[model samples]
Target: MGNCNSCPSKGNCNSDSGCSGLVPKYGKIKHIIGIISGKGGVGKSTVTGILAVQLRKLGYTVGVLDGDITGPSIPRFFGINDKRSDISQVGDGGEVKFAPVETSMGIKVMSLNLLTEEEEAPVIWRGPVITGVLKQMYSDTEWGELDYLLIDMPPGTGDIALTIMQEVPLEGMVIVSTPQEMVSMIVKKVVIMAKKMNVNIVGVVENMSYVICGKCGEKIRVFSKKTAEEQAEYLGLPLLAEMPINLDLVESMENGNVEDYVSKSEEYEVLLDNFKNKIGI
Candidate 1:
């Protein structure tokens, strides 16, 4: 039986006797990032989308593995309408394999939204089944030669989140949260969880910390006055960036085109730099 020390898998191998959930590496992936939040509606998926596009802009081959199985929105954000995952057969016995779908910006993506006939269909799956799908996507999907593979993990310290922390070979994780006391409290839980799992905490992102008034151009703290500094200090991690609430960004998300949104926004342009510097892209 292989212990953690003897395990060949460079990724998180939660099993002592070699992880049976180990996904075969089909392509060359340089870095794997997990974007997580303590709760939903903190723009975790939005950050994932922004990072993917920004990295691609910086001339890196990037892909996103939508780990949020129940509420897969990566496909929607990328504006991919393909409802089917490409397949291939291996060996004489005809073992089937799944190919990740590509976006218009040449970003590779794989999500449950593409597999389901109805995008709005509820996953309605139990814990084990959801985790099994995540492992399958990691093992079975062909994400060829990506410099960065960002995983859009579901919110909270749930089963899927734990499964990913235990399984995926995460280079690091970026925690997303708003500038609210409750949100900051929850963010700490995620940070602690990452440390316990031996996952590197890259940094924290404060989403919707404030908004710019149209008339006065003043920064308004719509959510809370808590700064990214406080959150970072709480997590004992660096504050990567603090994102303001923008109507244009909201529109982009609503239209399922965040790449376009980030390209035009001056704020995200600066964020791109901060992100690159922190993660050493």
Candidate 2:
């Protein structure tokens, strides 16, 4: 029998007996990758959006599961915040399934923001409710045939994070952090948690590692340059990419046009290449 750790039955019955129900019945996802961080404001969601767009551009079908239920931003980044997912009944038992909204570039996305009446409304639910919603979003959404499904996880090792690590069949995880020493220090907690859960750590992405001076066109290291490298080495993981603070990209995301940025930006070409190589895509 296969590992029943993620099965809804909690391993009471053998998976070979056809009692397992962990994998989403409606989706054939080739790879499920979680984008996570130890703390907030580390640009984890942005990284997720960029990766989805880049992967789609490479002719691979991709999907984004906004696992950050309380602070869902995947829809906004992909310009699908105003759209609602379509619900339909499927199967002999009449099981309800949600059709994920597609972005301009055709990347499927499912998020709490898409279901809510107002995007600005706060998700006031407690831990259990939030985790339940996350599981439903993963299992109930009709993701179709996808090469990659990226889960933009909430920050920290909390209830939602633990639920995903425990229940979701995550192929790997990409840890996001800034170059600040404090952030790097906190990111170690995430690495430790992933190890404890027996999840593969794909690598670390150092976001906002530097900024470019507009007048001189020089790369300025805002934080210590060695922090991310040192952190990755300490965690025994590869440094996937050192992303600079790009104002244009920020503006693009703010405008809900991340696909445009991915296509037009020459700077992100290196990031895309590095991420693809590290992810083995």
Candidate 3:
């Protein structure tokens, strides 16, 4: 209920701004998942995009909060870039909030990319400042009756990510990882940080776990030998998925449209369906 300074949950919190997101008695959502990665370039935002669409297809109200301050890509991934409304006051002067751009799938999305004029412009914000903005997004936005609020967090266990985990009441988190060995070690840091904050580990999404041969569709393990599955097992977590590398999928995402990027294989579909059920949406 105060400024996020010297809070009890230090390491887990990324920000301690003037955020009362969980204190309000007006309404609340069922699930809030933070899509976090151990490091960068692991397709964490891509996983967030697919998850929102799948939940909407199942007939649920979805909302996404782009928590990555320095690099906010969720809006671009959803084709809502360059769309922003002026901030207006909520009911009874509660807080001045902006309207989230609506995606084709009807998932309400918010990100700094939509607010900014340039997509590639560097956002030089400190850790505490970024954390305060995250609280503003959560408390100020018009996320009414959401079935899920998927937060696209920045890569690594840095200051901002830690602040959000400590201050915000997270329902669960989906850890994104590749099969690389060095990155696997950092993932343990993310897990330990989450545990320290008492946030639930819903599932682990292994992006780029393998590469599928174009002609024969043979699954090729591009990175480390048997490190990904081993990590999940050692952590005693459910292997949510093993996403294979696909170029066409990557190409589709470059334009910020995921409306038609459906997984062709049965295994991918099973993984998608299980994620929805696991989250109970």
Task: Please tell me which predicted candidate would have the highest lDDT against the true structure.
Answer: 2
Which residue ranges in model 1 land beyond 4 Å of their true spot?
Answer: 1-21, 81-83, 92-94
Clashing residue pairs in candidate 2 (N, C-alpha, C atoms within 3 angstroms) = none
Ten-residue stretch with the least lDDT total in model 3: 2-11
Candidate 1, poorest ten consecutive residues by summed lDDT: 1-10
lDDT of 2 by residue, 1-281 (tens): 32343333344344465533347767677778899999899899889988888888889999999999999988877777889998888778977888899998999999989888899999999999999899888888998888889999999999988988887767789999897778877888999999999888888888898888999988899778575677678767888887888888878877987798787767667667877777676
Clashes of each: 1, 0, 8
- Predicted candidate 1 versus true structure: per-residue lDDT over 1-281, tens digit per residue: 32333223446444555654354446667778899999999999889988888888878898899999998888877878555777788778866678888876789898988888878889998999999888878767787777888999999999988988886667788889898888888878999999999888888888898889999999998777767787678878888888988788778767867677776667777667877787675
TM value for model 2: 0.89
Q: Is candidate 1 or candidate 3 better by TM-score?
A: 1
Give TM per candidate. Answer: 0.88, 0.89, 0.85
- Spell out the clash pairs found in candidate 1: 11-169
| Residue 47's lDDT in candidate 1 | 90
lDDT of each: 0.81, 0.83, 0.74
CA lDDT for candidate 2: 0.83
TM-score of 3: 0.85
lDDT of 1: 0.81
Ranked by lDDT from best down, the candidates are: 2, 1, 3
lDDT of 3 by residue, 177-273 (tens): 8777677777768888888888888878888888888899888887867956696775557778888887767676676655666523344565576
